[model samples]
Structures are given as structure tokens and as C-alpha cells.
Target: MSLREIKPGNHGYLYVNSHPTGCRAVVDRMWQQAPEPAGDRPGPVALVIGSSAGYGLAATLVGLRAHRMRGLGIAFESAPTERRTAGAGWYRTARTAELAAEAGSDFTFINGDAFSDSVKEEALDRLAAGFGKVDVLVYSIAAPRRKDPLTGEIHRSAIRPLGTDYRAKTLVFKEGVPQIGELHLPVADEAEREATVQVLGGADWQLWIDALESRGLLADGFRTVALSYVGSDITSPIYRAGTIGAAKQDLEDTARAINTRLKGTGDAYTVVAGAAVTQASTAIPSIALYISMLHRIAGDAWQGTSDQAVALWDQLVGNAELELDDEGRIRLDGWEMDADLQAAVRTAWDRIDTDTLAASADTEWFREQVGQIYGWDVPGVDYEAAVETTVPWPGSPSTDA
Candidate 1:
């Protein structure tokens, strides 16, 4: 092993390497902060579909450490290579397995393409052999593309408006300085629009549920949630009212369809989550700028992905009751979308520019949060010293994936 100073490979959405130490530290903090279990009976067995990073990983921690549930996490991640470490999610899953082991909670992780029918079958087989039945399933997959299992066609998702061009203030870095810059996202074409829906929409989610249900893997009163986002006015033109929005609407529709198919044996919901710094969120236009402002306005009170995941579990499984909006979807973004908060964010958004970006938003904090996603800005990690570049993904049978 040699000392490696990993940095952002691009505008900051992608990184060259991930630090195992920092990743473990971040997971440890989330596990420590998660609320204790609310029920005296044994917790539910859960299968978190995207449980490696972001909300999926947080939900895994919530289930294993908070609710004391047995969990099986499925994610697609790059394993450690000769010249580079594994992706941040890989390290996170390995560490999560360790934490689960310490707590005597059963946790299994599979790293593979979740959209593949073979992978779904593998997950189902694992569920049958180990978990027996799943009471909870969290669909939190975010990908730029997907390969259709039935047709063998690859569908790629795009971040673009529907009919009209979208111009917005997006976060950009000039010579390593965070700046508010204008982004002009053109409307996606017909084929691109359909492709976006194919990749990001509810089709894959429905497939997973159907596979599990067909195998008699879903326990009675089974509950599943697909994480989603609906942006504010400043971002709606490029986000909520864009191609992504259409896909999210499909996701909600799929939830209703699943409910109908289950015939009260289970429930499905599309959970609208608050904006957080995730790999997918960073790539979206205007999200970085908006999230920076959210961080600024809610300093010390800002709820990160882990906090949001905990709150979600509390409502979904803890003592709290499940609250739904008019559309029957869980609206966990309510706190982030408070009238006063959005007003403050809009005021900052209006004034933000390269000159006033730092003052209008917590640019440094935003950058740090992004760095922490790949285990860079985490506190007390000795980045200067040589660290292992090939951290083993504990007990993962699909490490080669």
C-alpha cells in the first residue's frame, strides 16, 4: 500500500478512490445515531434493494441497528482494484456487515446489477434460504442507466426538461472555487424521454416486488417504499417538471398498482425524500446550489440522509403513525419544503452568483459533505499516511460484479 490523496475526478460527482477508514467512520456514526427499537417483539426481516450508500445504506443501518432486524442488502458497486480502492458503497457495506455481526444481527450483502433478472433470482433464493420472508423492502436504487432483462436493451436516464429548455443557476467549480453558474438543459427527445422513464421509473421496482411475491417471499403485512424526490419551484423546470418527474410519477403509480395486486397482504409507497448530497443528486442541475442553500439556512438543524432514514423508519415501523399526503404517498420532504425555509432559499437563490455564492450558501460545507460521501472530508482520518487501497468486501459473493 502507498499513500494516496484521492480527489474529485470530475466536477465533484465522481471520485477517483474511496477511503475505507473514513467510510467505516461514517457508517459507525450513523449506526450510533439511529434510534433504539420501539417494539418489544422481534423486528421485521428486511431486504434493502439499494443498500450500499445514500438513503439505502442509511435504511439498512436503521433496520439492523435501530429495529434489530435481519437484513439482506443488494447493490451494484465496484470492488477494490490493484490501483484503486472499491467504491464508497463497497466499503460501507463491508463495515455495515461488521457492525451487524457485532450486534448479533443477521446481515447479508450482494453486489450486483439489481436490474438483471438473474440477480433478482439470486436475491430471492437468498431470501428463501436465509431470511425465509421479508416484512420490509426498501427500493432506493439510483442509476444513470439500466439494461432491460426481458428485451436485452440498455436504457439510459437523462436529466432534462420535457418540452421547453430549462435555464437555472447550477453549482460549478472554477479553478476549485465553488461558483453559481448558469445551466441550460435542453429538452430531451422522444426516445431519450422514454429511455429516462425506462431507467428511472417503476418498472424495475415492480419487477423486484413481483419476483419476491411470486416466490412467496413477502411476509404478511409486508411494506415496501421507493425513495423519490420532488424539487421546489426553482428546480422544478429542470427536475420535478422534467423527464425525471415523469418517471417519479410512474413510480407512484406503480406503488398503487402493487397495493392493488397485493389485495391488502402488503403495502407499497413512493416516499418523497428531502434533498441530500448523494451521487445522483450531485449530477442533477440546480440541486447542488439548492442543497447548499438548504445547508446554510438550516445550519446544525439540517437533516442528512441518515437522519431522514431514521425518521422514515420511525413512521414506518416505530411507535409513530404513518402519515400520507392526498395522493397516499409519504411526504417526508415536508420539513425541507417548509414555507419559510423555501422562501429563505429562494431569496438566496435569487441573489446567488459567483460573487455572492459563498455568502448566500454554505459552499464549503456543501463541498465537505460531498467529500464525505467518498470518505475524504471525514474528521480524523489520516489521509497523509499510506492506507490500504484494496479493502475486502466482507462475505460478498458478488464482489467480482
Candidate 2:
């Protein structure tokens, strides 16, 4: 099939062939901008969880581009191939490895459930044998649900205000229209909520760090960071203040715990990042509508996923001192979610006419943003080229078949 025939949700295969040249362009820019190692040591090694797509992938790219760090990415999903779609990180790892090879830097990828103990052990073993230790660790995993490895029970999450019924306007991205809906907060028993907390919260993070430390895989002066978002009060009850909020609270608290573990080790610290639209973010109710309205109010052209990732990378690695409020969380989304800004967006959302949504709302730009998440809309390449690819999944032979 031709590249144009490839759909946006069809894994990430189309990215390899759709804009091969543009992909090369980004790789070249990364290589040129990447800093050189000060000494004879191979540059710092970075391990990024959730490094398949969104901010995680951007962090990996930035490590190579901005810091000249060799990286190992751990992703839970399948890798994308020319004939089949793969997860976001899968394609990203493949692409990054391809670029790193050309740039003469080390890049390895592991495909497994990062939350699994076996996977953690394998990853530590690989890092120990290959790089000895990692100088930076980035945790950006965002999963909606997880199976209890011990109990084998499935748990799901909901987006709603805790303890109160709330009504909100939601945007139907495909339809490009606003739909008002009632969101019922989950009334699941405390056991379920606790399970959700255990699965989605900071336990996995703690496990990763503990495993790495036990294996002696963390380098001295290393920095470890995790991403979290506390949306505005409008979303507080459902997100920052709800069950998920509780989970995020645990995550934030875990950061402090991890920080304590890293202290007195010369230069270790933890960071909690601000909000941005990611694949995970788009799945949350009311967020798309919120982002659409915010995009209109900002007036500056909206950026694609790659653009947002680049912005975040610039902030985190290129400029580490992100503007923080008294609370210590980086304030990028705080500025975006400022009361005044949100009020303006709320007004714009209210003003959106139902009949003329195509003209009234920048649906085209939103669609492009969605497309760019899977590497569509990139420039300077023929989407018709046939490109072969491979992922690091075990027993999967590297093939052009």
C-alpha cells in the first residue's frame, strides 16, 4: 500500500516512509546541536521510560541532540514495522537508533512491560553489560490501566470530579463539534481505587530505582526526573484532585522519596514537569476541548507533537532551570492554565458556534497535531518511499521480508 493509504492510527509504521527525508532533517539537526563529551568517557547514558512517544521520545531525542548522551529506551508496546503498525516508542526507538548509528553514538532499545520485574532485571543486565551505568533516568510512563501482575485482575480508570456530579463540554475531534456530557465519577470501592493507585502511581517508579540501585546501575552525579501534570481547578477534581489526582499525589511524593535516596550523592535531584498534549493527555475528557480553546486564545500558531516535545526538551535539558512557582513544580502548564488564560479560553469555548465549527474552530490544526503524533505532516519527503524497519522485541528476526 502507498504511504498516503496509511491511516494515522495504524501504529507508527507510516512515519518511517512518509517523511524519510524530513526524519533525516530532524536527525541532522539533533546531531549538529548535540553537545560533545567533555572528556574521553562515552557520553552519559540515559534510560527513558515511556520513551516510545510524546514527551518520553522527545526526552530521548533531546538527550542525543542536546546533551550528546547515548540512550536506552524501555517501551511496553510493540515496535512499528513497514508492513505493520507499532507503538509510538517502538517507532521512535527505531528511528533514534538509526540516527544514533549514523552519528556514532550508542542507542539500544528494549521492548517489554517496564512494570514487570523480569523486564526490569533484563534492562538492568543490559545496561550493566553495555554502559556500566546511566547518568540520567527519565520516567514518563502514562498508562490508563494495568493488570495486577500478582492477581491478574484488570483495572480501569475514569475521568470525573470526585464526590460530586459534574457536567462539562467535550470536543469530538473527528466531528469537530462540541458535545456537552455528564461525567459520573467512579464509585468503585476503596479496594479498586487503592488498586488503581498501586498500579498507576509510584510503585513502578520505586521498583525501577530500587532495581537500578541494587544492581549498581546508577552513576554518581546522576539526575532522575518524572513527568506529572496538575491541570487547572476546572480539572482538579477529575484529575489533580480525583482518584487519578490521588495517584499523582503518590507519584509526587514518590519523587521526594527517590530524591532522599539520591541525596548526599553529589548532584542527584528529581523534577515534576508541567502539562502538554500527549497521546495520553488527549484521552482525558474535557482536555481536548480545553486545549482547542487554549490554542485559539494563544493566537500563536499551534504546534504539532514534535514541536511540543522539542519545546519541552529545550526546557528540561537545554535550560534546566524551568520557572517554578513556590510549590516547586515547573510552571509551563501553570502559565498556560493561568486563571486569566483559562477564563479567556472558557469564553472562547462558549462562543464557538455549532453550525460553523469548521470555520470557528481550528480543527484542521488540531487534526494536524493528532497526525504529527504518529510522524505525519512532516516536511520534505515523499510519503511513497518503501522503508524497512525492525524493533528489539525478542525472537523477532531483523528482516525486510
Candidate 3:
């Protein structure tokens, strides 16, 4: 089979195989922009949970290559080979290791379930010998469901509003047409909110930190952050004020707890990033529609996942004072929630429909961005070249992929 013949999988779920050319392009972009370490300043060692794609993967790159930090990544990803499709995250993790090896940087990737106590223990085990004194921990998990290791209780998060139902125009972009329809989500009750928090909240984040500190694994000035999103009034009802919002509120409270516990030694905070058409975000009905409309209005300003991650790395590592909001959360969604930009987006949101969607919505751009997530839209790669699928997993040496 030819590489160019590899297309996106069903409903934007997986890529049949890893495209070597496309995968290389993804990591190369990070290396090209990677910064050098300063003299007299050794890079900080970092531990990145959910370090497979999106901000998690980008943060790994920034820490290991851009900031010259030693990095230990924890993620759950699959491997690609001649007979089967591997998720986009597989390529993201593999390519990052390949790049790290080329530069002779210390980058260790452990492909295990990160939300488990055993996994946390494994990380602690490797901290002293593999990489010492983790100075930063970046939590970027985006699982839809999680099973607690202690209780064995499975928790699922639903994307719906609280108090009252919500109705909005949802969108799905296709090859040439945009499918726009009204999506209504019934209000979630107390039980659903609790489940969402159990799965998506910062409990696990706090748990990992406590485990690390208990073992004396964290170095001085240690800091941890979990990414979040609280968008405009347009998306507030279904997003910022919904089941997901309840979970985020719990995350904020957890960050406060962590901060209070670490008072003089370290700090934990939640950073709200910009709205992007992420693989995870695409799963949310109303969010996808809003982002399509947003891209249409902010054509030049439609920030993608990498944009948010890269900017975040620069700000965090640039040696400047961290700029935070009233609640003490880092605000990285400035332009995304800009009053004037959102006013324009609100106008577009009110008029968006299937008929107007093709012309008025940035479906084409949205489609391309989605494809890029799975390493499909890269240019100059001979997708038709006779393929080789021998890429190895990050920690294993069999090269089954």
C-alpha cells in the first residue's frame, strides 16, 4: 500500500497507519522552533501526564527540546504497523522519541495508563534513577471516562448543561458540505456532575502530586498545572456552566488545595487555554459548531492546538512573572474571549446554518485541521511512496509498528 493512499479513519477517530512523512513533519515543526538552554541554567526536569497529543505532547517537546529539560512522559497510546491502524497519538509519541534521540536529550516515554495508582508508583520508582527531582508536572489528560484504581468505580462525563436544557446549532464538516443541525442536551442532575468530576476533575492530579511529594520526588520550586477552558457567554451555558464546568470548578478547588498545601515550596494552578478544534473538542456537539463559526469569523486568528501549547510554553518558560486572573488561574484564552472578537463571533453564531455554513463557516479549514491531527494533511510527503511501517514504540525495541 502507498502512503498517500492512507486517509482519515471513520468519523475522525483513527488513522489506519502512521504516515512517516507526516509524522516527521509534526515533530520537525517542534524542533525547528525549539530553543536552546541558557548558560549557567540547566533545564528543569518535567513529568508530563497524557503526553501523547495536543498540549500534552507539545509540552513534552517544549520541556525536552525547547527548554533543554530532561523529560519523563506518561501516556496510553497504541502502536501502528502494516496490518492495522494506529491512533494519531501513537505517531505523536513515537516521533517525539525519535527526535529526542537524534538530539541526545534525555526523553523517556512510558506507555501505560496514567490514571492508575500502579502507574503513579511506577513513575515514582523511575524518578530517582531515570530522572531526578521533577520540577514541573503538566497534567493534560482528556479521557471521556475513568475507572478509579482504588474504588474500581467507573466514571463517565456527559457534555450537557445544568439547571436547564440547552439548544444550539451543532455542526459536522464533510468533504464538500457542512451538516448543521440543532442539538439539544437535557440538563444534568447532581449524580452526573459528581461523575464528571470523578472522571475529569483534578482529583487524580492532586493524587499524583501528593504521591510524589510523599516520596520526596519533587524538587524545590516545583509547580504543576492542568489545562482548562471557560469560553465566551455564547458557549458558557453548554460549556462553562455545564457538567464539564462543574468538573472544572472542582479542578479549580483542587488547585487551591494543592497551592495551600505547598505554600512556600511550590504552587499548583489551572490554566484556561483557547478554543481549538481538538480531537477531544470535536466530540462535543455544540463546541464543534461554535469553533467552525469562530474560524469563519477569525480566519487569521483561528488558533490550533499546537498554537495554544507553543504559546503556553513560551510564557511559562520565558522567565517572566506569571500573569493570572482574579481566581488565580492562568488565562491563556485572551484573544479567544476577546470582547470585540467574540462580538463578531456572536453575530456569526446567530446566523450560522447548513445553507450559510459552507460560505459563512470555515468548514474547509476545520476539516484540514482535523486531518492534520492524525498526520494526514502534511505537504511534500509522497503519500504514494511504497511504505515502511517499522516504527518502534517509545520504550519497546521490537519495532512492531
Candidate 4:
């Protein structure tokens, strides 16, 4: 295959093509930018579901680079074909392998649908054969739909409000220019609510834990965490008070149930992460607007996914004590939820329109962050250079492929 520069082929929230070289560079920067490990601590074997991009990938990198742990990551990603490139997650995984190798860490990546029973079983077998047991499990799967492995039923998640139509000012692009837009989201019906919970909730996390324990693959002092989100007042109507919130509530409940099942053997907690630009977040109405303004206000102090991951490791394994809320969930969004910051954000929100968007928000930074998600706008990368789209992932071939 001949080398060629790859630009993002989709608009708004999704990217259909990725540049392998640029993706690797982004991963490399994250790995390098991470703080050094605290000490010569014994490495734990970690299993990270949805461990290819976003917070999942960040968690995997934290395990390998910060704690020196061996890891197994399960992510569903596309394989490259003759006419197209694989997703950014594929290239990120490949880069992870290289960094892990340099750090004397080992990671076994599985490319398959994490919701499937077959993939779960394969992970169990791999743990039994290669690592013996897993000390940490990070559940970070984010998908639009999930297929029930036992009943063959499919559930799709929704982003609608719970009881009323939600209207919010959102960030949008018109003819390649950033502007303010509005979103009017309707209420989610009972069926849609249930489906959202089934797809995005902790049902899968519970199953993964149950399977590991049933097979005696959980190591002593085991710990698990599922990523979560709780939007601030700015996005409460469309986010925290919406269908996605219901799913997150279920996730919290599952963590509690999993803790009870652990019964002194291990613990489970839901981690509410800080706001950042991710593919999933992009899909959420007003999130981009909020994040962009937040970035502008917070400047360099804002926590990127990598920063959040390092802080997570500090709480989970390092010396820092876990900052728990009243509900016993870990809080990583303290900075994002600061009172003064919120006030500033709201003030900026009220002032933003297409005419004022450029001056009011960090639209350039916002666009750059979105572009980097698909490996397009990383600094120092030669986008003019030719590159291969058929980059091989350092993992098992996808079953579908």
C-alpha cells in the first residue's frame, strides 16, 4: 500500500478516516507527558474493557505507564480495508503496545465486541492462561447499542430528556466556521429510557465482574471502576436530568451491587470524570459549547483525559487518598465543577452567539481537540507527508473481519 495523508472524512461528532502516524504521535505525547511512576511498586494485571480510545485508552495507559502493570484491553474497532483506514482507536492500541514494550510492560489487546459472551469468555481464558488473575478491572465501554449475549436482544441508548423537551445553546459549525446553535431534545419514553439503561448502565460491568469471579480469575485485593459523568448546571437539563443520567445512575447502582458481591474480597466504585472533548461528548448537545468555554476559562489548568487518568491512578494505587462523595463515588471533576468557574462559564454561555463565539470561546482549541480525536491536528505532525492507512493493530483480528 502506498503512503498518503489522511484527513477526517466525516463531519461534527464522528471521524471515518484516521492518519496512523498522527495517531501514534498523540499517543506518544500522552505517554511521555504522564508523570513518572512513584516507586518500584509491584505491577498489577488489569483488564480494561473499551480500552482503545477516550477514557478507556487513558486508563490503560495509566496502568501500564504509571503503575507498571500488565494489562488486557478489549475494544471493538474496525480493521483497515483497501479503500479506507481503521478507526483511531486501532492506531492508538498499536502505539500503546510500543510504549508498553519500552516500559517492560505487557498488554494483550482483544478486538471484539465487549458486550458479547464469546468475547467475555475469551478474555477469561486469556487471563487464566497468561496472567492467572486480574487485580484491576476498568469498565469504560461507551456505545450507542449493545446486544444481549444471552437473549440475543439489542438495546440502544438515548440522549433525550427524561420528562420534558430540552432546549439548549450548542456549539456548531457552519461552512467550516464555529457558531452557536440550539438543540431541542424531546423527552425519552419508557422504552427508550429502559433501553438506554440497558445499553449504557452497569449491567455489562456486573456481568464482567460476575464472570471473572465465577471463573476464579479475580486476584486478591481486586478493584474495579466504571467511568461516569455528571454534568454541571449548564448541561443539567439535557444531560444530568436526562436519559443518559438514568443510565449513569444505574451504573452507580451496579457498582454498589458489585461491592456487595465482592464481600470484603474487593471493591467497586464509579468515577465521575472531568469534562473534555471526546467522540461521545461531541454527540451530546451543548457539551462542546460548555467544554470550549471551560477550556477558555481554565486555560492550561484544565484536565485532559490523560491528566484525569493520572489523577485516577494516584487515587486508585498511589499515595493520594480517594476523594469520595456522599454517595461513595470517586470525584475527578472537582476542578470542572468549581463555583467560580461555573459562574464564569454561565456568564460566557449567556453571551455566546455566532457573532461572538470566536471572541467568547476557544473555538480554535476546540476544533483542534476535535481534529486530534481522528489524528488530524496534532502539533509537529507533518500532515503533508504520506502515511499508511492499513496500519496493523497490535491485537487479535476482529471476529467480523
What is the per-residue lDDT of model 3 for residues 58-173, given as tens digits with 9 covering 90 to 100? 77887776577776888887766556656667777888888887767777888778888888888888887888788888999888888888899989988889999998887754
Separately for all candidates shown, the number of backbone clashes (residues 3 or more apart, or on different chains) is 0, 3, 4, 1
TM-score pick, better of 2 and 4 = 4
**Model 1 misplaced regions, further than 4 Å:** 1-14, 38-40, 396-401
Give the TM-score of each candidate: 0.95, 0.80, 0.92, 0.96
Q: Candidate 4: which stretches are off by over 4 Å?
A: 12-14, 395-401
Model 4 deviation from native, Cα RMSD in Å: 2.2
Best by lDDT, which number? 4
Q: Which stretches of candidate 2 lie over 4 Å from their true place?
A: 1-42, 79-83, 147-155, 173-189, 266-275, 301-322, 353-360, 377-397
Per-residue lDDT of model 1, residues 110-192, tens digit only: 88999998889888998899889999999998899999999999999988999899888888887788877888878889888
**Candidate scoring better on TM-score of 1 and 4:** 4
Candidate 4: 10-residue stretch with minimal lDDT: 392-401
Q: Point out the worst 10-residue segment of candidate 2 by lDDT.
A: 10-19
Looking at model 1, the pairs that clash are none
TM-score of 1: 0.95
Better of 1 and 4 by lDDT: 4
Cα lDDT, all candidates: 0.85, 0.62, 0.78, 0.87
Best by TM-score: 4
Residues 171-240 of candidate 2: C-alpha lDDT, one tens digit per residue: 6633433443344445445665676677668877888888888988888766676777776666665677
